[model samples]
Target: MTTPPFDPPSEADIATVSAQLGRPARNVLGIAARCVCGAPTVVATAPRLDDGTPFPTLYYLSHPAATAAMSDLEATQVMPVLQDLLATDETVRDAYRLAHETYLADREGIAVVPEIEGISAGGMPVRVKCLHALAAHSLAAGPGVNPIGDLALAQGDWSPLVCQCVDYNKDRASAGQ
Candidate 1:
């Protein structure tokens, strides 16, 4: 596996991610993607968390706006639609399979957990289980890498190109709970 394409997290990044998550961001390896406001939007976490559990979600969406957007998309019952696309569109299936492979490679580059090997977040390769994970992967890898993720993101009301973060400088309401 090659080196993961992400920057090491800074103290501010850790703090921002913690605030976005409303809890301590444990075992965060790096900042995968950032919002337009420069706040951490996606984080790269350890394959195995500190407690030795096999946590396979390597790219975690942290920004409240992005998280909310993904939640809204999920609430719309889009997973089944995308899953159908995967079942019929060979091109989409091929790309999604590649996304799963890329996700695994990125995780293995950092650390490999035997229990989670061959598993990628958001039900990649075969299903569209979590928009949050898929969106996080899309943001971290950039567009065209994760087609389903990109499609889900396109369906969202929020945009990373514009800062939709809610009061990053002050305590505020979190969308989509």
Candidate 2:
């Protein structure tokens, strides 16, 4: 299939697509909760104490309601808005910061649990998982001037697999587990 032309996305466009898809204006707290606790499985594991341990990871759909709400036409219409968000410097920076913060929080929270194994550092694992999630979301959502690609590229080999895991987990969650 031929790739469509890339254009900047706008908030108005996002709203339009969201409306057509019946996207609800859920609160951030709700969104965060869905992200953390709604998934079928939530676990933190490590092979050894010194080894880097994966923290309490929960995966959920980035846009749960909208995923089902959006038709192909609506998604196509919203593509420009998504692209614009990806292309803007501020948006890119903000997204990275959010992902980074999420990672740090996950790491810190997992570190105190004591049940998890293989944890040498909490920060890096969190960052890795966050990046993986972001990349997976981007790829599934479709590519158009993605800013998160930088972080995914930095990790290279692992990013794709992590993204795949993110996708898998999200799918599993949406399936009602």
The numbered model that scores best in TM-score is 1
What are the lDDT figures for the candidates, one per model? Answer: 0.90, 0.34
* Weakest 10 consecutive residues of candidate 2 by summed lDDT: 25-34
Per-residue error at 65 for model 2, in Å?
4.1
In the range 23-47, model 2's lDDT, one tens digit per residue, is 6322111122112323211112211
lDDT tens string, model 1, 59-125? Answer: 9999887888899889988889999999999999999999999999999998878999899999988
Q: Considering only N, C-alpha and C atoms within 3 Å, which residue pairs clash in candidate 1?
A: none
lDDT of 2: 0.34
Stretch of 10 with least lDDT, candidate 1: 168-177
CA displacement after TM-score superposition, residue 175 of candidate 2 (Å): 16
